[model samples]
Target: MTSLFVDRRGVVLELESGAIVFRENGERIGTVPIAPLSRVFLRGDVKLPAALLGKLGEQGVGVVILSGRIGRPSLLLARPHNDAVRRVAQIRLSFDEPFCLQIGKTLIERKLTRQIEWFTELRENDMQVRYELSHALRALEEHWPRIGHASSAASLRGVEGSAAARYFSGLQAVVPNSLHFSGRNRRPPRDPFNALLSLTYTLLHSEIAIALYGAGFDPYVGFYHRLAFGRESLASDLLEPLRPLADQFALALIRKKVLEKDHFSTTEAGCLLGKAGRTRYYAAYGEHSETLRKGINQEIEWLTAQVNEIMATAEDDVRSEDDFEDFG
Candidate 1:
C-alpha cells in the first residue's frame, strides 16, 4: 500500500510477529507493519535478517537496494504472476513489426504531446523564458505529425530523439543559471539537474518493472525499445511516455531549492547526491510517489487489457486455421 525507505547506515531489520523492527546500535529505532507495505527501499549500510526477506517476498513486497555512491539499485522482487501466457503474448508481439511500430508511435506521440503541453504551460507563466520555450514548442509540434507517419522503429526513435532534444533545451531555459543544466546528459550526468533526472528516472524505471512482473509481462521484452542484454527494454518502453512526469518532478526540486549544487559532490566518477541531500530527496519523493504510482498502475492496467486482447485474437485465429484444415 505504501513504500518504506531505509537510508540510514547500520540499521538492522528484523521480523517480529509480522512487522519489521528497525534496530540501530542494539536499540530498537522503529517498527513498521508489513501488511501495508508494497515496497522497501534500502540504501547504504542497512542490514536485514534473511527471514525478513522471505516474509517480504511472501507478502508480495518488493525490496529495492540502492548501493554504492551513485546508488545503483538491485531488486529482490516478489513472486511474479503465474500466468505465463501473458508473457508469451508479449514476446510474440515484440516480433510483430506492425504492432511494434504502432506501439512505438503511440508511446512517442504521448510523450511529445505531454512535453508540448508542459512547455506551453510554462510559456504562459514564465515570461522571461517564453522565447526559448516557444522555439522548443514549435519543434515538438513539428515532430508530432512525424510520429503518426513513422513506418519503422528506427525512424520513430529518431523523431523521439529530436523532440527530446528540443524539450530539454526548453527545460534548460527554465532551470537556474547556477545549475548549469544544458540539454540532457547522463551516465555521469554532468549537471545537477541531470543528476536529479537520472536518479528520478532510475526510481521510476524500477517501479514500472515491478508492476510489469506482477502483471505477468516480461520486463525485458519491448515494443518500442529493442532488446539488449541487462536492459529492461519493456520497462524502458513503458517509461517513455512517463518521462515528462519525472522530468517535471526533478525540475521542481531544483526550482524550489530542495536540491541545490551544494547538495552534490563531483569526482571523476560523476556528481553524487550527499547523504543529507539523499535523505531529503527520499522524503520528498515519498510525498510525490502516490501520484506516480497511480499513473503507473493506470498504464499497467491498460497494457494488461491490450495484451489480453491480442492473446485472445491469436487463439481465435489458430482455432480458425485448425477448423479449416479439418474441413478440408
Candidate 2:
C-alpha cells in the first residue's frame, strides 16, 4: 500500500493522462502514476482537479486534504463501498460497548506490556531509567486488571493516560541531551529533529486512522482515548500497538542527526516544518508505514482467529462467522 504525501509548498497537482504532475517554480519536476496507490495526502497549498479526485475515488484510493498550520485532516475522498450493509455493520460492531471495550483492552494491555518490555531492555544500558520504568510497570500492572471492570470509556482512558505518561517520561530520558531534544509538547516540535519526528508520526497516525475507518470502526468511539472534537478516538485505541515502530523510526533519525535546524521554521504562533523537513519526514513515513501496515495486518489476522474461536464456541444462532468478519 502506497501513501502519497504531498507537503511541497506552492505546488500545483494536476492530472496529466493517467498520472499526476507536480509543478514547482514554473518547472515540472515530478509525476506520479494513479496506479498501485492506496492513499494520497494533500498537505500544502496545492490545487487538484475535481475529475482527478473522482478517478482516485473510483480506483479505491483514499485522498485526504490537509490544511497548513492546522496540521489536521480537512477532507477525505474515497471510493464508496458497494456493500453498504457490511460497512454499516462493521461500524456498529466496532462501537458496541462489550465488543469494542474487550478488543480495546486487549490491544492496550498488549501495547503496555511491549512498552514495559522495551523499557526493561533500555534500562539494562542506562541505570537512571530503572526508577521510572519500575514506576511505569507498576502502574501498568495495576491498571491492566481493571480493564475488565471498567464500566465507561473514561475509566479505561484514565488508566491508559497514566501508563502513557510514565512511558513517555522514560522514553524522553533515554535520549541524550546532545540532540537538543526535550520531552513531548503540545505545540509543534520546537527543534528540527523533533519536528521531523512529529511530522512523520502524525502522518503515520493519519494513515492508520484511514485504515481503521476502512475497517468500519467508528473512528470517534474509543476505549483508552477520550473523545474530543475532531479526535479519532477509535484510531487512537487501535494505534497503541503500532507506536513503537514510529518511535523506532524517530529514534533512528535522531541518532543519525540527519535532521538539521534548516529543516524547520518558527512562527509567532507555533513551529512548522519547512519543505525539506516534510520531504524527509514523508520518506521516513513511507518506510515506517510499510513496516507498521504489515504489523497491523498481522494483528487483524490474530483478532480474526480469536473471533473465529468465539464463534465456534457459541451457539450458531447467537454467533455466526458473518458477525466475526464484520469486526475484522
Candidate 3:
C-alpha cells in the first residue's frame, strides 16, 4: 500500500463509488482507486467528510493529520487486530521492569551503533563530516559500556537524550551548507532542516504506531516509554532506534540538492515545505516504497518475538499467561 499526501488547502477529498476523488475550487483534479491507498495524509487546511473517513476505516487505511507550520501530527488507526492473547502478553511484558531496561538499552545501543556506522561511511569522502561526527561518536562510545548497567528506563533515557544531542549536532553538520540547521528544536522547528526532521519523524511515528497495532501489540503500552493517556508510548519507544533512518532520508535530500532553499518557506513560527518540495520529497518516500515499510514491519515482528523470548526466560518472575483473565 502507498500513502497519499494532500498538501493544498481548500482541497476537498471524498469517496466516489470505489475511488477517492480530489476536488479543488469545485472541480475534480484527481481520482485514485481505494485499493492503491494504504494511508491518507492531510496537511494544513485540506477538508474531508465523515463518509470518506468511514470508507477509509472500512478499507483499513490509516489516516494522518499534520497541523500548523511545524507539522505536528496525529494518527487515526484502523480497528485493532483480533489477537487477545498477544496483547495480554504485551501488557505483561511492559510491567516487567528488568526486561524493559534490557530492551531500552538494546534499542539505544542499536541507535548509537547505527549513527556511528552511518557517519563512518561518509567520513572517508568528507573529512569535515568525519571530524564533526567523531566528537559525537566519542560521546556515544563513552557511554556504551554503561548501558549494560542501566538501572531504569528514566536513567537510560537520560543517556539516550545526551547521545541524541551530540548525534544531531554532528548530523546538522553533514547537511548542505546552504540549508540551515542548528541542533534539534521542535514544537516549532526553527529552520528548514529542523522542519524536515520533525515532519519526517512525525510520519515515521505514525507508521510505527500502525505497524504495532496491526502486529497485535498494544501501541499504547511499551517497554521503555511510560504509559500516559492517549499516548502510543510503545511506538514512541521503538521510534528511538528507528529515528536515524528518518534523519538519513532528510539529509540525503539536502546533500543531493534535490530540494533547494527555495523549496521551503520561512515563517514566524518556523519553516514549511513548499508544494514543489513536498512533491519531490514524497516521490522518494511515498507508497510502493516497500524498503522502509518492510523494514518497519520486520522490526515490529522482531520486537514482538523479543518480548515472547523475554517472557520465556523470565517466566517464573511473572504470573502464568494462562492464569490471566480473558477479556471475553
Query: Could you say which candidate leads in lDDT?
Result: 1
Comparison by lDDT, 2 against 3, better one: 3
User: For every model shown, what is its TM-score relative to the native structure?
Assistant: 0.96, 0.78, 0.87
Alpha carbon lDDT at 75, candidate 2? 42
Q: Candidate 2 clashing pairs?
A: none
Give the range where candidate 3 is weakest over 10 consecutive residues by summed lDDT: 287-296
Residue lDDT tens for model 1, 1-328: 7889999878999999999999999999899999998889999889888899999989988888988877888888898999998888899889999988888888788888878888999999999999999998988899978888888999888888888888888999999998888788888888788888999999999998888898899998998898999899989998998999998888888878888899988788887788888888998898899888887887788788877888888889998988884435
lDDT of each: 0.88, 0.68, 0.81
Sort by lDDT, top down from the best: 1, 3, 2
lDDT of 2 at 36: 71
- For residues 1-328, could you state the per-residue lDDT of candidate 3 as single tens digits? 8888888879998889988899999999999888878788888778888888888878888888878665667888876788787889889878889878888988889888878888777776688677787776787688787777778888888888878888878887787767667789887777889878887888888888987887788889988888999888998888887778788788777877877889898888677788898888887778324666776876787797897776666666565665788889
Q: State candidate 3's TM-score.
A: 0.87
Best by TM-score: 1
Deviating ranges (above 4 Å) for candidate 2:
25-27, 124-152, 178-182, 187-198, 221-229, 266-268, 299-315, 318-328
Off by over 4 Å in 3: 287-289, 310-328
